[model samples]
Target: MPRMKVLLISLAFVAIIGSLGAALYFMMKDSGDKPKSSHMARALAFRVGFSILLFVCILVAWKLGYLRPTGIPLQG
Candidate 1:
């Protein structure tokens, strides 16, 4: 795997984890009876977007021949 691809994938994974952590934080910290849904929503949106981005990256890698399936053998 190329360094650039590895770096990008790792960063995307970190971003996704960060977004999830943020969402959990917002959910746990909002207890003042004020509307805190926005924060959580935003965090969730970020997580979803990052997940999609990661998926796209993987697809692109596969299409570009950077990624390939392994560890399975067909018993034809």
Candidate 2:
């Protein structure tokens, strides 16, 4: 894989982790034993969006001939 693709994939992963951490932090920061549903929802949305973005990136890479399938060879 190229450097740009690697960088993007890593950044996406980091963003997803950050969102999750933020959600956890907000959930734990509340008093009165109430969870922050808004933060959790936003984090969830971010994660989903990032996942879709990653999927699109992969699809684009494949379409652009940057990715290829590798497996055992078949003989007939």
Candidate 3:
């Protein structure tokens, strides 16, 4: 990959993590011990955002060559 492309990809990954973290924080903060709907939404938002962050982290690691994937497959 070119230097410019790598830089752009890294920036994009960082942005994804930042935006998801902010959203999760706000969602949890806004939820109070009142409505069940709010609580559910908050929980869902946090989980989804967290998952996105994990994916972004993996992408970043792969881009920087810090993550190596093996061909081993595991069955659940």
Better of 2 and 3 by TM-score: 2
Q: How many residue pairs clash per model? A: 0, 0, 0
Across residues 10-48, which tens digit of lDDT does each residue of candidate 1 receive? 888899999999999988994865566788899999899
For model 1, the local distance difference test gives 0.87
Candidate 1, position 16, lDDT: 93
Tens digits of lDDT, candidate 3, 39-73: 55665576577667767877897889866677788
Q: How big is the positional error of residue 4 in model 3, measured in Å on the Cα after superposition? A: 30
lDDT of each: 0.87, 0.81, 0.66
Better of 1 and 2 by TM-score: 1
Among all windows of ten consecutive residues in candidate 3, which has the lowest summed lDDT? 30-39
lDDT of 1 at 38: 86
Error in Å for residue 37 of model 3 = 0.8
Which stretches of candidate 1 lie above 4 Å from their native place? 31-35, 72-75
In angstroms, the error of model 3 at 24 is 17
Where does candidate 3 stray beyond 4 Å? 1-34, 72-76
**Reference-based lDDT, residue 26, model 2:** 74
Q: Which ten residues in a row have the lowest lDDT in candidate 1?
A: 30-39
